[model samples]
Target: MRSAPGEFEIIRDYFADAPIGEGVVLGVGDDCALLQPPAGALLATSVDTLVADRHFPASADPAAIAARALRVNLSDLAAMNAQPLWFTLALTLPHSDAAWLQKFADGLLQTAKAYGVSLVGGDTTCGPLSITIQVTGSSVKPLRRDGARIGDAVYVSGELGAAAAALPVVLGQKLAGEPDRDAAERAYYFPEPQLATAAAIGDIASSALDISDGLLADLGHICAASGVSADIDLHALPVAPLARQLAGERALELAASGGDDYQLCFTVPQEQVATLEKLGLDAVCIGTIVEGQGEVHAWLDGERWFPEAAGYEHF
Candidate 1:
């Protein structure tokens, strides 16, 4: 009893006169959108998918879901130290709901405007709910996870584990008392991808990756990719006061293995740590890379510590 999405309706309401690129030679309503890049620019493209009951909750507001979908993709670009330029959207929905579409589109437009990116081309299909976004950017140099070197110090931007902490609250697994639940909720819903901060780090950081997974799990990617070992100091990690108070002794558990932080984690030389300190970035020297291999385990109070939970597993 639902209407199938047709190209004509989508064109008139959603795609007609859609803004594409500043240097777009061919925009949408064509076989493919054509773009012309500047001579000195290098193209960086990333694609991400958000499915209902997987990437996000079915009950979440459409505007927030749209913003988060775009933000998560943007976070990937930020990890590579690229400035976002344009994007293409592919949407699958069960039916044409005008109210929901309006909110989703408004959120998408607002997020794109905020990040200086433009919507170029895409398609809409009738199916289960899903959003696929491909964003493109330009960078002279891309920060990769494999550039970490022996003797470089590991650093993380902002506090860790708030997003994971909020998960329990959202699912009714935990009760609200202090600021922990509130902080966690904010981190989970409105993740501020560290684009400008990563750009500031530039070539200074030898290797970098965004912390979408737990700290140890995400850092393990850098370690495995770079063939190095990382030693993290539990005391050195910056845990939010609210989370620490709520978690008590379990603070380390949340910090080590909780996911959805969306912060930048990178490795910098010991000598450059001082320079980075002056930049007003709340970067913490939580660990150091050494001439070894494998994922990072922590040392707290001179005892080997392992978190009970791992990062988010898509399986």
Candidate 2:
């Protein structure tokens, strides 16, 4: 009888042939990847781990899970106004399933190619199923959390709350029509990284971050880092339509406090607002920075509003 494929054999078969991009000196099959980062550009790197049943449903499609893992990590690069360059995937598998690994690798490499990032190197280990991806990119004039100033305009790229609303459908806890189910799956599995918008606003935005932990919660990070506060107009939010369909009256609250949209939330100084407008980006100003310590205040129809949940907490 044939034995199951070992760790190195699995890597050699499924992940060895990833597309090699410009800066890759040595890619897979080596102990470590040798990369040549672009001169005169700062390197921005971020890592994220998605555990089965926590970040994603354990029984979901392997390909979809792989795509989600890589895409979300790439979102971190976008938030820093970085150009996609390279990434590493550390995969922990309960067992060496050849079919599952092939599907996962296919999804991961396809998404990497689409985003112009190359897979460098990573490790495979035996454990509970989890995927950890670390992405590195080059950035010129990178946006940061501490760059927001009082009087700056707060903005977000694209709509929000769709992914959070899709949770029920994704987990199979709720049934939906075909259209809603497809929309929910798309939002949950294949969130866009907003790299183009981030690049467009890189020079203009004073502060920026990707909204992984709800708009209000992530915006508070910028506030805390910049020693400022924000005043958000609830009516100005561009809530996703899918959120309204799934979450109903709670759509607004979900948009404010639900996580996993992977959209960019940024601040622009008053002087650069005109410049930003000229760029014709798909971004909307939702609020303004105010002189206060790290607090975010929301007003709905001129009345103070608060969300029931702050955001996702790991602990």
Candidate 3:
């Protein structure tokens, strides 16, 4: 029989030491975590769930899995230009191992503290390995998908393709110890949420989203929501150098259609490009919103192109 611990014991041992953020009026051990949203700011909430071998490899480190689970949710908040306030964790495990739980909790709480978020409340149960996190944030005026407009320039933060490049190695398809493989592993395990950039350019961004799905797919979402189209320049993508190790066009394909990048994709007016540059944001101008509805056209040397695959969708 698998060893299981009591729910309260799980909480007491693992989640008790979570940081207390400014918005947490009441924290763990309560029926409901009480949160006080900041004055003049609307609460932004997002939830993400990761199952073993689906969202992550079963062989992945527990701490890395925990961090990725929470960070994905935090990336959503960042997309809205929100400040993280609090979070609740729901955990399911085949069996409770003190060491594994402790490591997971350490990663979770440490990440929360780094983002100034508090762990408020949650539940623990015996089941398959899974984690669900609900994060609440605040924003005076969050960027929305519907806010994109024609003539807006699309921008993406950071480099893409590394996390996707690491997938083969993570699945044991590629050998470890390669230079690019190591970088891909780091990118896959520790994707940074773009909170600082989001906050800095919040007022300037017309629409914003995180690139969990491939860039083209997620960019298409903004266009669909805004009833527009996009023309992306292949030459302008901020692809990571790790992708150069790939065969011809595979790098661009990964940057276009491979998932798990978790970078921000946002739209801004051409007039605001100087303002964004002055803000010192790490980004690249990849495309422009046009009149067509929901269509994303990729261009290389003035010709239309498309990625070989679409983003991941479980169905």
Candidate 4:
């Protein structure tokens, strides 16, 4: 059996080579990371925590855990059309397993490289396994939920609910069988944040949010913030193919209520629809904003449909 390494040894061996650029004066090894901000853009920051049992299976691959923890925060940056510059990680482990740490660092560093972000600084400690990531980004005219108008069209990026569909499989509650099963498990393990397309959409999307929670629930947040109502065409939701195959009759419900999709949901004004289309974003028009209080009227084939569960709950 491999021996557990000490904290500094783990840092030196695993996290010491974190990529640095974009005004990062110091990273990882320093007492505090020093950063120089770029001009002409506003800074955007987001933080996310992933707990072992609540977020992922306790026995999940350490690399997958690290990826999920960081990607979720990056999703927040994508929602605001922000580009990530730097990030810090705080990891708590039951034991300092060197192999696990190495896998985790590989995942973190690779994702950081793909997203053009540097690992600035962080701390490690012993405890129940959990990961927290703080991401720093920049944006010009950050998308705000309150910016939607009554005439705006609501849209979403990518297909939804595959990750949620894999939950039963992840927990081993369902027997793994089928092509869809593999697809769903892949989505659950490595959810791709819509960072690239988000930048492409840019200010064309007036109000935007990442669908970390279920589509309906996260859309409701936008409605509440904008003090507007919406008419969501349930059939228009771009449900993932695997989600439909796996969920069967519950596909729509899962798409509306299943969290962790991490797709971008946004609205564009009637006048700006052409501009948004010109950007060639992989988004679908799912609903329309209207003149009313924050009431979301979900419709399916000309009739209203409401589900029992809304989405994942923080409390």
Better of 2 and 4 by TM-score: 2
> In model 1, where is the ten-residue run with the lowest total lDDT?
3-12
Per-residue lDDT tens digits for candidate 1, residues 1-315, read 565433434733654434555767765556577888856878889999999888778777788788888888899889999998888888988898888887788778778878887777777887899999999988877899998888999999988767776776655564646545556556677788789988989868999989888899999999999999898998888885645665666666787788777889999988888788888887888989988786686888888788887777878
RMSD of each: 3.0, 2.9, 2.6, 3.3
Model 3 ranges off by over 4 Å: 1-9, 175-181, 246-249
- List the lowest-lDDT window of 10 residues for candidate 4: 1-10
Clashing pairs in 2: none
For candidate 3, write residues 118-209 as lDDT tens digits.
Answer: 88888788888889899999998698888888999999999888788777876667553454655656788778999998998888999999
TM-scores of all models?
Answer: 0.90, 0.96, 0.94, 0.94
Cα lDDT of candidate 2 equals 0.91
Report backbone clashes per prediction: 0, 0, 0, 0
For model 1, what is the C-alpha lDDT against the true structure? Answer: 0.81
lDDT of 4 by residue, 1-315 (tens): 443432343566697677787798866665677899999999999888889898888888787788888888988998888888999888888987888889989988888888789988887778899888999999987888898889899999999878888778767785535545556567887788888878877768779999988988898889999999889999899988778777777878888878888999999999999988887778999999998887788998899888788766789
| Per-residue lDDT value at 183 in model 2 | 86
Return the number of clashes found in candidate 3: 0
